[model samples]
Target: MEKFTKISGIAAPMPMINIDTDMIIPKQFLKTIKRSGLGVNLFDEMRYDGDGNEIPDFVLNKPAYRDAEILIAGDNFGCGSSREHAPWAIKDFGIRCVIAPSFADIFYNNCFKNGILPIALPQEQVDILMNEAQKGANARIEVDLEAQTVTTSEGEVISFEVDAFKKHCLLEGLDDIGLTMEKVQAINAFEAGVGATRPWV
Candidate 1:
Protein backbone atom coordinates (compact mmCIF):
# COMPACT_ATOMS: atom_id res chain seq x y z
CA MET A 1 0.00 0.00 0.00
CA GLU A 2 1.23 3.50 -0.78
CA LYS A 3 1.43 6.16 1.88
CA PHE A 4 -1.31 8.80 1.58
CA THR A 5 -0.33 12.08 3.15
CA LYS A 6 -1.82 14.74 0.88
CA ILE A 7 -3.20 14.83 -2.65
CA SER A 8 -4.42 17.67 -4.86
CA GLY A 9 -6.06 16.66 -8.13
CA ILE A 10 -9.21 16.51 -10.23
CA ALA A 11 -12.40 15.33 -8.52
CA ALA A 12 -15.15 13.60 -10.47
CA PRO A 13 -18.69 14.08 -9.29
CA MET A 14 -20.99 11.05 -9.15
CA PRO A 15 -24.22 12.14 -7.50
CA MET A 16 -26.01 8.82 -7.80
CA ILE A 17 -26.58 7.12 -4.50
CA ASN A 18 -26.10 3.45 -3.66
CA ILE A 19 -23.24 2.89 -6.09
CA ASP A 20 -22.57 -0.73 -5.21
CA THR A 21 -19.65 -3.11 -5.61
CA ASP A 22 -20.97 -4.75 -8.77
CA MET A 23 -21.41 -1.39 -10.48
CA ILE A 24 -17.83 -0.57 -9.64
CA ILE A 25 -15.96 -3.48 -11.27
CA PRO A 26 -18.75 -5.94 -12.17
CA LYS A 27 -18.84 -9.67 -11.30
CA GLN A 28 -16.96 -10.99 -14.34
CA PHE A 29 -13.84 -9.03 -13.41
CA LEU A 30 -13.76 -10.46 -9.87
CA LYS A 31 -11.96 -13.65 -10.78
CA THR A 32 -8.52 -12.05 -10.63
CA ILE A 33 -6.98 -11.66 -7.18
CA LYS A 34 -4.37 -9.22 -8.38
CA ARG A 35 -5.12 -5.57 -7.59
CA SER A 36 -3.45 -4.05 -10.63
CA GLY A 37 -5.19 -3.76 -14.02
CA LEU A 38 -8.60 -3.39 -12.45
CA GLY A 39 -8.52 0.37 -13.09
CA VAL A 40 -9.40 -0.21 -16.75
CA ASN A 41 -12.52 -1.98 -15.55
CA LEU A 42 -13.47 0.43 -12.82
CA PHE A 43 -17.10 1.41 -13.29
CA ASP A 44 -16.99 -0.94 -16.29
CA GLU A 45 -20.74 -1.23 -16.72
CA MET A 46 -21.29 2.51 -16.57
CA ARG A 47 -18.23 3.41 -18.59
CA TYR A 48 -19.07 1.09 -21.49
CA ASP A 49 -22.14 0.47 -23.62
CA GLY A 50 -23.60 -2.86 -24.77
CA ASP A 51 -21.09 -2.96 -27.65
CA GLY A 52 -18.20 -2.18 -25.29
CA ASN A 53 -17.77 1.37 -26.51
CA GLU A 54 -17.01 4.14 -24.05
CA ILE A 55 -20.14 5.87 -22.84
CA PRO A 56 -19.79 9.55 -23.49
CA ASP A 57 -21.96 10.65 -20.58
CA PHE A 58 -20.26 8.68 -17.85
CA VAL A 59 -18.36 10.99 -15.47
CA LEU A 60 -15.21 8.86 -15.67
CA ASN A 61 -15.30 8.71 -19.47
CA LYS A 62 -15.56 12.46 -19.83
CA PRO A 63 -12.23 14.00 -20.84
CA ALA A 64 -12.10 16.31 -17.84
CA TYR A 65 -12.55 13.55 -15.30
CA ARG A 66 -10.56 10.79 -16.99
CA ASP A 67 -7.63 11.45 -14.66
CA ALA A 68 -9.60 12.36 -11.56
CA GLU A 69 -7.82 11.36 -8.37
CA ILE A 70 -10.73 12.14 -6.06
CA LEU A 71 -14.44 11.35 -6.23
CA ILE A 72 -17.31 13.38 -4.79
CA ALA A 73 -20.21 10.97 -4.58
CA GLY A 74 -23.71 10.76 -3.18
CA ASP A 75 -24.97 9.02 -0.06
CA ASN A 76 -24.74 5.30 0.62
CA PHE A 77 -21.76 5.00 -1.67
CA GLY A 78 -20.39 1.46 -1.90
CA CYS A 79 -23.51 -0.28 -0.64
CA GLY A 80 -24.21 -4.01 -1.15
CA SER A 81 -21.65 -6.85 -1.03
CA SER A 82 -18.45 -6.43 0.98
CA ARG A 83 -16.12 -6.80 -1.97
CA GLU A 84 -12.60 -5.49 -1.34
CA HIS A 85 -12.13 -5.25 -5.09
CA ALA A 86 -14.23 -2.07 -5.13
CA PRO A 87 -11.54 -0.11 -3.36
CA TRP A 88 -8.81 -1.87 -5.32
CA ALA A 89 -10.38 -0.74 -8.57
CA ILE A 90 -10.84 2.82 -7.29
CA LYS A 91 -7.24 3.02 -6.13
CA ASP A 92 -5.93 1.45 -9.31
CA PHE A 93 -7.88 4.07 -11.23
CA GLY A 94 -5.82 6.70 -9.39
CA ILE A 95 -8.62 7.87 -7.08
CA ARG A 96 -6.97 8.45 -3.74
CA CYS A 97 -10.05 9.77 -1.94
CA VAL A 98 -13.84 9.29 -2.03
CA ILE A 99 -16.01 11.97 -0.44
CA ALA A 100 -19.64 11.21 0.22
CA PRO A 101 -22.45 12.13 2.59
CA SER A 102 -22.20 8.59 3.91
CA PHE A 103 -20.81 5.19 2.95
CA ALA A 104 -21.45 1.53 3.71
CA ASP A 105 -19.49 0.41 6.76
CA ILE A 106 -17.70 -2.41 4.97
CA PHE A 107 -16.69 -0.28 2.02
CA TYR A 108 -15.54 2.54 4.25
CA ASN A 109 -13.19 0.23 6.13
CA ASN A 110 -12.00 -1.39 2.93
CA CYS A 111 -10.94 2.00 1.59
CA PHE A 112 -8.64 2.59 4.53
CA LYS A 113 -7.08 -0.86 4.14
CA ASN A 114 -6.43 -0.22 0.46
CA GLY A 115 -4.87 3.23 0.96
CA ILE A 116 -7.99 5.07 -0.21
CA LEU A 117 -9.51 7.70 2.04
CA PRO A 118 -13.28 7.27 2.31
CA ILE A 119 -14.58 10.51 3.76
CA ALA A 120 -18.03 10.77 5.30
CA LEU A 121 -19.11 14.36 5.47
CA PRO A 122 -22.43 16.07 6.09
CA GLN A 123 -24.75 16.28 3.09
CA GLU A 124 -24.33 20.03 2.84
CA GLN A 125 -20.56 19.78 2.72
CA VAL A 126 -20.70 17.04 0.13
CA ASP A 127 -22.99 19.19 -1.98
CA ILE A 128 -20.43 21.98 -1.86
CA LEU A 129 -17.68 19.66 -3.00
CA MET A 130 -19.91 18.15 -5.68
CA ASN A 131 -20.52 21.59 -7.09
CA GLU A 132 -16.82 22.31 -7.14
CA ALA A 133 -16.08 19.01 -8.86
CA GLN A 134 -18.57 19.86 -11.59
CA LYS A 135 -16.20 22.58 -12.75
CA GLY A 136 -14.03 19.88 -14.43
CA ALA A 137 -10.26 19.51 -14.63
CA ASN A 138 -9.52 23.08 -13.71
CA ALA A 139 -11.12 22.65 -10.32
CA ARG A 140 -8.73 20.65 -8.21
CA ILE A 141 -9.59 19.36 -4.74
CA GLU A 142 -7.00 18.77 -2.06
CA VAL A 143 -7.30 16.11 0.63
CA ASP A 144 -4.95 16.17 3.61
CA LEU A 145 -5.13 13.03 5.71
CA GLU A 146 -2.84 14.47 8.34
CA ALA A 147 -5.05 17.56 8.73
CA GLN A 148 -8.32 15.66 8.26
CA THR A 149 -9.54 18.25 5.80
CA VAL A 150 -10.67 18.58 2.16
CA THR A 151 -10.14 21.89 0.40
CA THR A 152 -12.05 22.81 -2.71
CA SER A 153 -10.66 24.70 -5.69
CA GLU A 154 -12.31 27.92 -4.57
CA GLY A 155 -10.47 27.70 -1.24
CA GLU A 156 -13.34 26.31 0.81
CA VAL A 157 -12.14 23.91 3.48
CA ILE A 158 -14.18 21.13 5.07
CA SER A 159 -13.00 18.97 7.92
CA PHE A 160 -13.73 15.25 8.16
CA GLU A 161 -13.29 12.60 10.80
CA VAL A 162 -11.32 9.37 10.50
CA ASP A 163 -10.40 6.58 12.88
CA ALA A 164 -7.06 7.15 14.60
CA PHE A 165 -5.64 3.71 13.85
CA LYS A 166 -6.70 3.81 10.22
CA LYS A 167 -5.20 7.30 9.84
CA HIS A 168 -1.89 6.01 11.18
CA CYS A 169 -1.92 3.04 8.83
CA LEU A 170 -2.42 5.21 5.76
CA LEU A 171 0.16 7.79 6.75
CA GLU A 172 2.73 5.05 7.32
CA GLY A 173 1.68 2.94 4.31
CA LEU A 174 1.02 0.01 6.60
CA ASP A 175 -1.48 -2.57 5.45
CA ASP A 176 -2.20 -5.75 7.42
CA ILE A 177 0.88 -7.40 5.91
CA GLY A 178 2.98 -4.32 6.52
CA LEU A 179 1.78 -4.12 10.12
CA THR A 180 2.85 -7.74 10.72
CA MET A 181 6.26 -7.08 9.24
CA GLU A 182 6.82 -4.35 11.83
CA LYS A 183 7.04 -7.07 14.49
CA VAL A 184 9.18 -9.48 12.47
CA GLN A 185 11.97 -9.52 15.01
CA ALA A 186 9.63 -10.44 17.86
CA ILE A 187 8.00 -13.14 15.74
CA ASN A 188 11.39 -14.60 14.85
CA ALA A 189 12.47 -14.63 18.49
CA PHE A 190 9.30 -16.44 19.52
CA GLU A 191 9.77 -19.07 16.81
CA ALA A 192 13.39 -19.66 17.82
CA GLY A 193 12.45 -20.16 21.49
CA VAL A 194 9.70 -22.61 20.54
CA GLY A 195 12.07 -24.64 18.35
CA ALA A 196 14.71 -24.84 21.14
CA THR A 197 12.17 -26.13 23.70
CA ARG A 198 10.21 -28.50 21.41
CA PRO A 199 12.89 -29.92 19.14
CA TRP A 200 11.83 -33.53 19.92
CA VAL A 201 8.47 -32.89 18.40
Candidate 2:
Protein backbone atom coordinates (compact mmCIF):
# COMPACT_ATOMS: atom_id res chain seq x y z
CA MET A 1 0.00 0.00 0.00
CA GLU A 2 1.22 3.49 -0.83
CA LYS A 3 1.16 6.33 1.66
CA PHE A 4 -1.61 8.82 0.96
CA THR A 5 -0.89 12.27 2.28
CA LYS A 6 -2.27 14.72 -0.24
CA ILE A 7 -3.43 14.41 -3.83
CA SER A 8 -4.50 17.02 -6.36
CA GLY A 9 -5.84 15.56 -9.58
CA ILE A 10 -8.72 15.16 -11.97
CA ALA A 11 -11.98 13.89 -10.53
CA ALA A 12 -14.49 11.85 -12.49
CA PRO A 13 -18.18 12.25 -11.73
CA MET A 14 -20.35 9.15 -11.57
CA PRO A 15 -23.75 10.21 -10.33
CA MET A 16 -25.40 6.80 -10.52
CA ILE A 17 -26.06 5.26 -7.14
CA ASN A 18 -25.69 1.68 -5.92
CA ILE A 19 -22.54 0.84 -7.86
CA ASP A 20 -22.01 -2.69 -6.61
CA THR A 21 -18.91 -4.88 -6.63
CA ASP A 22 -19.90 -6.74 -9.77
CA MET A 23 -20.34 -3.56 -11.75
CA ILE A 24 -16.91 -2.45 -10.70
CA ILE A 25 -14.79 -5.36 -11.94
CA PRO A 26 -17.39 -7.92 -13.01
CA LYS A 27 -17.40 -11.61 -11.96
CA GLN A 28 -15.26 -12.89 -14.78
CA PHE A 29 -12.44 -10.56 -13.94
CA LEU A 30 -12.37 -11.80 -10.35
CA LYS A 31 -10.35 -14.92 -11.13
CA THR A 32 -6.97 -13.34 -10.51
CA ILE A 33 -5.91 -12.54 -7.00
CA LYS A 34 -3.30 -10.09 -8.21
CA ARG A 35 -4.41 -6.45 -7.97
CA SER A 36 -2.44 -4.83 -10.75
CA GLY A 37 -4.29 -5.83 -13.94
CA LEU A 38 -7.72 -5.07 -12.61
CA GLY A 39 -7.47 -1.38 -13.45
CA VAL A 40 -8.14 -1.96 -17.12
CA ASN A 41 -11.20 -3.91 -16.08
CA LEU A 42 -12.44 -1.43 -13.55
CA PHE A 43 -16.09 -0.83 -14.28
CA ASP A 44 -15.67 -3.35 -17.09
CA GLU A 45 -19.31 -3.73 -17.89
CA MET A 46 -19.88 0.00 -18.09
CA ARG A 47 -16.67 0.80 -19.88
CA TYR A 48 -17.11 -1.79 -22.62
CA ASP A 49 -19.86 -2.72 -25.01
CA GLY A 50 -21.11 -6.20 -25.95
CA ASP A 51 -18.34 -6.46 -28.52
CA GLY A 52 -15.72 -5.37 -25.99
CA ASN A 53 -15.21 -1.96 -27.50
CA GLU A 54 -14.79 1.04 -25.24
CA ILE A 55 -18.05 2.77 -24.56
CA PRO A 56 -17.73 6.40 -25.49
CA ASP A 57 -20.21 7.71 -22.92
CA PHE A 58 -18.76 6.03 -19.88
CA VAL A 59 -17.14 8.57 -17.57
CA LEU A 60 -13.90 6.59 -17.30
CA ASN A 61 -13.65 6.10 -21.04
CA LYS A 62 -13.98 9.78 -21.79
CA PRO A 63 -10.64 11.39 -22.59
CA ALA A 64 -10.87 13.95 -19.86
CA TYR A 65 -11.52 11.43 -17.10
CA ARG A 66 -9.24 8.63 -18.31
CA ASP A 67 -6.57 9.63 -15.85
CA ALA A 68 -8.82 10.80 -13.05
CA GLU A 69 -7.33 10.11 -9.65
CA ILE A 70 -10.48 10.97 -7.69
CA LEU A 71 -14.10 10.02 -8.08
CA ILE A 72 -17.19 12.00 -7.08
CA ALA A 73 -19.99 9.50 -6.91
CA GLY A 74 -23.66 9.33 -5.87
CA ASP A 75 -25.14 7.84 -2.70
CA ASN A 76 -24.93 4.18 -1.65
CA PHE A 77 -21.75 3.81 -3.64
CA GLY A 78 -20.19 0.33 -3.47
CA CYS A 79 -23.31 -1.47 -2.32
CA GLY A 80 -23.89 -5.26 -2.56
CA SER A 81 -21.37 -8.05 -1.98
CA SER A 82 -18.31 -7.42 0.16
CA ARG A 83 -15.81 -8.11 -2.57
CA GLU A 84 -12.39 -6.64 -1.78
CA HIS A 85 -11.60 -6.54 -5.46
CA ALA A 86 -13.70 -3.40 -5.87
CA PRO A 87 -11.27 -1.22 -4.03
CA TRP A 88 -8.31 -3.00 -5.62
CA ALA A 89 -9.62 -2.16 -9.06
CA ILE A 90 -10.28 1.43 -8.07
CA LYS A 91 -6.81 1.88 -6.66
CA ASP A 92 -5.17 0.13 -9.56
CA PHE A 93 -7.01 2.52 -11.85
CA GLY A 94 -5.20 5.36 -10.05
CA ILE A 95 -8.20 6.67 -8.13
CA ARG A 96 -6.78 7.63 -4.77
CA CYS A 97 -9.96 9.11 -3.29
CA VAL A 98 -13.68 8.66 -3.65
CA ILE A 99 -16.21 11.29 -2.51
CA ALA A 100 -19.77 10.19 -2.10
CA PRO A 101 -22.88 11.08 -0.13
CA SER A 102 -22.66 7.64 1.50
CA PHE A 103 -21.07 4.23 1.02
CA ALA A 104 -21.72 0.66 2.02
CA ASP A 105 -19.95 -0.27 5.25
CA ILE A 106 -17.97 -3.15 3.81
CA PHE A 107 -16.80 -1.21 0.80
CA TYR A 108 -15.93 1.82 2.88
CA ASN A 109 -13.76 -0.29 5.15
CA ASN A 110 -12.17 -2.06 2.22
CA CYS A 111 -11.14 1.27 0.72
CA PHE A 112 -9.11 2.17 3.77
CA LYS A 113 -7.40 -1.20 3.81
CA ASN A 114 -6.43 -0.84 0.17
CA GLY A 115 -5.04 2.70 0.46
CA ILE A 116 -8.05 4.30 -1.16
CA LEU A 117 -9.73 7.11 0.70
CA PRO A 118 -13.50 6.68 0.77
CA ILE A 119 -15.02 9.94 1.90
CA ALA A 120 -18.64 10.17 3.06
CA LEU A 121 -19.86 13.72 2.81
CA PRO A 122 -23.28 15.29 3.02
CA GLN A 123 -25.32 15.18 -0.16
CA GLU A 124 -25.02 18.92 -0.70
CA GLN A 125 -21.26 18.81 -0.49
CA VAL A 126 -21.08 15.84 -2.82
CA ASP A 127 -23.23 17.73 -5.29
CA ILE A 128 -20.81 20.60 -5.20
CA LEU A 129 -17.88 18.30 -5.90
CA MET A 130 -19.81 16.50 -8.60
CA ASN A 131 -20.41 19.80 -10.34
CA GLU A 132 -16.75 20.63 -10.15
CA ALA A 133 -15.77 17.22 -11.49
CA GLN A 134 -18.02 17.75 -14.49
CA LYS A 135 -15.64 20.45 -15.69
CA GLY A 136 -13.22 17.71 -16.86
CA ALA A 137 -9.43 17.53 -16.69
CA ASN A 138 -8.89 21.24 -16.13
CA ALA A 139 -10.84 21.16 -12.86
CA ARG A 140 -8.53 19.49 -10.37
CA ILE A 141 -9.69 18.53 -6.87
CA GLU A 142 -7.38 18.41 -3.92
CA VAL A 143 -7.79 15.90 -1.09
CA ASP A 144 -5.67 16.49 1.96
CA LEU A 145 -5.77 13.39 4.10
CA GLU A 146 -3.82 15.02 6.90
CA ALA A 147 -6.13 18.01 7.02
CA GLN A 148 -9.27 15.91 6.41
CA THR A 149 -10.42 18.41 3.83
CA VAL A 150 -11.25 18.55 0.14
CA THR A 151 -10.71 21.66 -1.93
CA THR A 152 -12.49 22.07 -5.23
CA SER A 153 -11.06 23.70 -8.33
CA GLU A 154 -12.89 26.91 -7.55
CA GLY A 155 -11.38 26.90 -4.02
CA GLU A 156 -14.34 25.68 -1.99
CA VAL A 157 -13.01 23.72 0.99
CA ILE A 158 -15.08 21.01 2.68
CA SER A 159 -14.04 18.93 5.63
CA PHE A 160 -14.67 15.22 6.11
CA GLU A 161 -14.31 12.73 8.95
CA VAL A 162 -12.21 9.56 8.99
CA ASP A 163 -11.45 6.95 11.62
CA ALA A 164 -8.24 7.72 13.50
CA PHE A 165 -6.64 4.30 13.07
CA LYS A 166 -7.50 4.11 9.40
CA LYS A 167 -6.13 7.60 8.87
CA HIS A 168 -2.86 6.59 10.52
CA CYS A 169 -2.61 3.43 8.44
CA LEU A 170 -3.01 5.36 5.18
CA LEU A 171 -0.59 8.09 6.18
CA GLU A 172 2.01 5.49 7.10
CA GLY A 173 1.27 3.15 4.21
CA LEU A 174 0.52 0.35 6.64
CA ASP A 175 -1.75 -2.39 5.46
CA ASP A 176 -2.38 -5.59 7.44
CA ILE A 177 0.91 -7.09 6.30
CA GLY A 178 2.73 -3.82 6.82
CA LEU A 179 1.25 -3.47 10.29
CA THR A 180 2.40 -6.96 11.23
CA MET A 181 5.88 -6.21 9.94
CA GLU A 182 6.09 -3.30 12.37
CA LYS A 183 6.28 -5.84 15.21
CA VAL A 184 8.67 -8.21 13.45
CA GLN A 185 11.23 -8.12 16.22
CA ALA A 186 8.65 -8.98 18.86
CA ILE A 187 7.28 -11.77 16.69
CA ASN A 188 10.75 -13.19 16.17
CA ALA A 189 11.49 -13.09 19.90
CA PHE A 190 8.22 -14.86 20.69
CA GLU A 191 8.96 -17.58 18.14
CA ALA A 192 12.49 -18.09 19.46
CA GLY A 193 11.23 -18.45 23.03
CA VAL A 194 8.57 -20.93 21.97
CA GLY A 195 11.12 -23.01 20.05
CA ALA A 196 13.49 -23.07 23.03
CA THR A 197 10.79 -24.23 25.44
CA ARG A 198 8.92 -26.68 23.19
CA PRO A 199 11.58 -28.10 20.90
CA TRP A 200 10.50 -31.75 21.64
CA VAL A 201 6.92 -31.02 20.62
Tens digit per residue, CA lDDT, model 1, 37-94: 9999999989999999999999999999999999999999999999999999999999
**In terms of TM-score, how similar is model 1 to the real structure?**
0.97
Sliding window of 10 residues with minimal summed lDDT for model 2: 28-37
Per-residue lDDT value at 45 in model 1: 89
**Candidate 2 ranges with C-alpha deviation above 4 Å:** none
The runs of at least 3 residues in candidate 1 whose Cα sits more than 4 Å from the true structure, single-residue gaps closed, are none
Each model's total of backbone clashes = 0, 0
Clashes of 1: 0
> For candidate 2, lDDT tens digit of each residue in 1-201?
899999999999999889888998788887888978899999998999999999999999999999999999989999998889999999999999999999999999999999999999999999999999999987999999999999998899999999999999999999999999999999999999989999975
